[model samples]
Target: MSLLKEAFERFAPDYLERYGQSMLPSHRRCLTDISSCQTDALDGSLHVCQSCGHEHYTFHSCGNRSCIKCHHLRTDKWLDKQQDNILPTRHFHYIVTLPSELRPIMCSNQKKSYKILMTSAFDALQKLASDPKHLGGKIGAIAVLHTWSRAMIDHPHVHMMIPAGAYNKDDDTWIRGREKFLVPIDALKSIFRAIFMKRMRKALPKQIFPQAIWKKKWSIHINTFDSKVENLLNYLGRYVYRIAITENRVLAVSQTTVTINHNGEALHLRGEEFIRRYLQHVLPKGFHKVRYFGIMHSAHKQTRNRIKLLLMNEVIIPDRPVKKKSTRCLKCSSTLILSISVLAPRNFNCQASVHPP
Candidate 1:
């Protein structure tokens, strides 16, 4: 069992009993799923070895996006799908962060706030890139939302990967950006802040925000990468299907406390507090944390193809070797054949049987 799952099994019951009524349905579901993941609470399949006739029963995973036990395959599949659409040019990585003062409000209104944050950030980028002083053409971007800091604090931000160029549809030409700089950081910050505040007001009319946040400078980081976008995409893929914490990061889980390794430092928290922090990062049901905009949008596939054709000689995406799964039997070192079964009950168990022909 994963340390995270063990921690949840130990602490989730008491936490839920104390605060179940106030918890979001998604959070409640996450707790149940993680606690029962890859266990008898879920279904299982039977596998038989071809050589030694060893029968192994494997339980199904919870499939919950927040569950660390699941989504490894899903993340790989996402990266493979994105590889085809990646532009063959230098890209800029942008991190747009929500101010500390707005975290409470954002957490309270998760779905709405997260959606607004992503769109607002992309809108600012599009607005700036379209100006004649800048690239002056339509730019494509992939924006991903992250809600947790290294210490599992609620820090909302969007990471955007944008190719350092634009595609002008009018003339069917590609306009490359400067080698290092994409846009002025100060100007981008101003535009992003104004757009986010305006959208927040329109989305939450009744909520009042502190005026000081408007005056204070928001944190925005811009990083430049060469034509190889695989690294950037891989970094973004890590957060797409998983939640704040992972099983490997969990150092120890005792009856009363959970300890995690954060930035090489051990941080301990009470079991209940650990559960609280983990649940806080479970996004609302059906909320998409990764989004595409402008030319990167699915609707603009034709445009992207044209851009790729124009930059075919210059584009260089490294060959990504697919990681194959091991199907060999552990007991006999022979091939294992799988046969999926219908959903089984909690007590369901499979005895050793011959391999089915």
Candidate 2:
């Protein structure tokens, strides 16, 4: 049996009410989808061990995306899909972020402005790389938007994957960027800040746009990138499906607040109202914060295919098959056999698609 089963058995009615049933409209729909996927009970009898006299029965998981007991399989599948997309070379990991002051604007203007930010950032990188003095080529990047900090605060930022080469349009040459430096940090920071702020101004109504954010001069930091591509790819793969806050992060949840120890120092933090605000900022319905750009962009597959061929350079990454991890019961010294079940399609994706968002 799994940990979920143990919890359900011990907790019974309360557990059933909380996780067994659906809450929101989306939840109800997902539950319905999962119900369609489950096989009938098929008339099985409970069994008991003769010597130990232990009895056990069987039940099923809702297989909903939001359910903690579920989604592990789905997360694994997503990780598999991304591993195929990684290219050979020293890849760099970069985080593009807006100042805390600009978060409210980001919240109000979610879809359009967010896309604009990605576009502007991407454009800046491409332009800087294409310059003969800089790198002189088109850079490939995968950008992911992260809206929350460790404690669930509304911190908007973009994590990017930049391989160290570009298709030089000018000379029609494959120019590898400086291994030590992909793009000049100061130059990228300057260009990215201007492009993002400019696009942001265009996204909002003139009346509501804040003059301070628009007019003021602020330093937007563009940090150093990683030298190893494999390291960067693995780092990105783990964070793709990150939850707002996990079990270990929750130090304590009082009647009025949830105390999250980010650094694990066990600091006692409080403020009921603040906690509410933090949770409230946890992404509204159908909001997709993660996105892909460059060759990975949905509409630009033609360009992506061209770039993929160029990056190959007769070098191929071996397909290392992934196997299930160790199968062991946590509480007792016992081996566990895993069963595979094809579940009814769940509404895990944003907009109720076939895949996770």
Candidate 3:
């Protein structure tokens, strides 16, 4: 079992008993799912080897987005799907972070705040990329929302991957950006801050936020990526499915404290405090951490295909189908067949072969 799961199984009940009434349903559900993940509390599948009649019983994954044990396969599959959409041109990576002053409001109003952050960031990018001084055309962007720092603090930011070129619909031409810079960092920062504050005020009409945050210079970091698009995509993929912390970072879990390794340094916190910090990043239910805009949007598939053909000078081919791997017996190294006895009693012994004679 993962150390994260163990920590939760040990401390979650006490944490919930103390704060369950005040916690969000999504947060509570994450606690339950992560604690019970891959345990007999959930369903399981029984597989029997066709050759040696060896029986293997495996518990089903909880499939919670916050569960560290889940989503490894999901991350790989999402990256594979994105390979078809990546453009051949250079791409720029942009990170737009929310001001620290607004974190309290953002935490209290998660769903609305997160949506505003993503849309505002994209809007800023769109406005700048369309200017005659910049690319002078509409650009494609993939925006991903990250809500935690490396140490699992609540630091909300949006990371965008944008092709360093734009498509002009008027005359059907491609306008390329500067080889090193996509847009002026100062201009992007100004635009992003303006859009974010404007929407934030509108979203929470009655709530009063610090006026200084409006004047605060929000952080915007832009870097040029000349490497393979997959490398960048892989980096962003890490944040999509998982939450604040992963299993490997967890070093030790005791009845009283939980220890994690951050940058080769050991950080310890009370189990309750650890649970509180982890739950802060659970996110609202059904929220999308990743979004596509402009030419990369699903609505612009044909336009993307056209651009691909123009760049590659060849007809675009459909992606080859991915074959599903069959499950195999651990002991016999033979393909396992699904048994109808999957619904067998919880006490059913794995040592007893259920394979047909």
Candidate achieving the largest lDDT: 1
Q: Distance from true position, residue 350, model 3, in Å?
A: 7.3
Compute the lDDT for candidate 3: 0.81
> In candidate 1, which residue pairs clash?
none
Better of 1 and 3 by TM-score: 1
TM-scores of the candidates in the order shown = 0.94, 0.66, 0.90
Candidate 2: where is the Cα deviation over 4 Å?
1-69, 169-172, 214-228, 253-257, 267-287, 298-321, 325-357
Report the lDDT tens digits of candidate 3 across residue range 1-357. Answer: 568878888899898888889888998898888776666677767776788877687666789998867877787688787878878777888898988988889988989999999999888888988898887888888999988887888989889998878898887877878977677778888988888878988989998989888677888887887655666777888878987877789999988999999889999989998998899998888899899999999999999888876677422333435656656567776765655435535664444322221
Per-residue alpha-carbon lDDT of candidate 1 for residues 1-357, written as tens digits (9 for 90 to 100): 568778888898888889889888888888888777777888777777778876677777888989877888788889999999989999999899977999999999998999999999988888988997998899988999999998898999999999999998898999999887677778888998989889889999999998779778899888888955889999999888887976789999998999999999999999988988888899988899999999999999999999999998885989678786666665876765666676767787644322220
Q: For model 1, where is the 10-residue window of minimal lDDT?
A: 348-357
Looking at model 3, the pairs that clash are none
Error of 2 at 61 (Å): 5.7
Ranked candidates (lDDT, high to low): 1, 3, 2
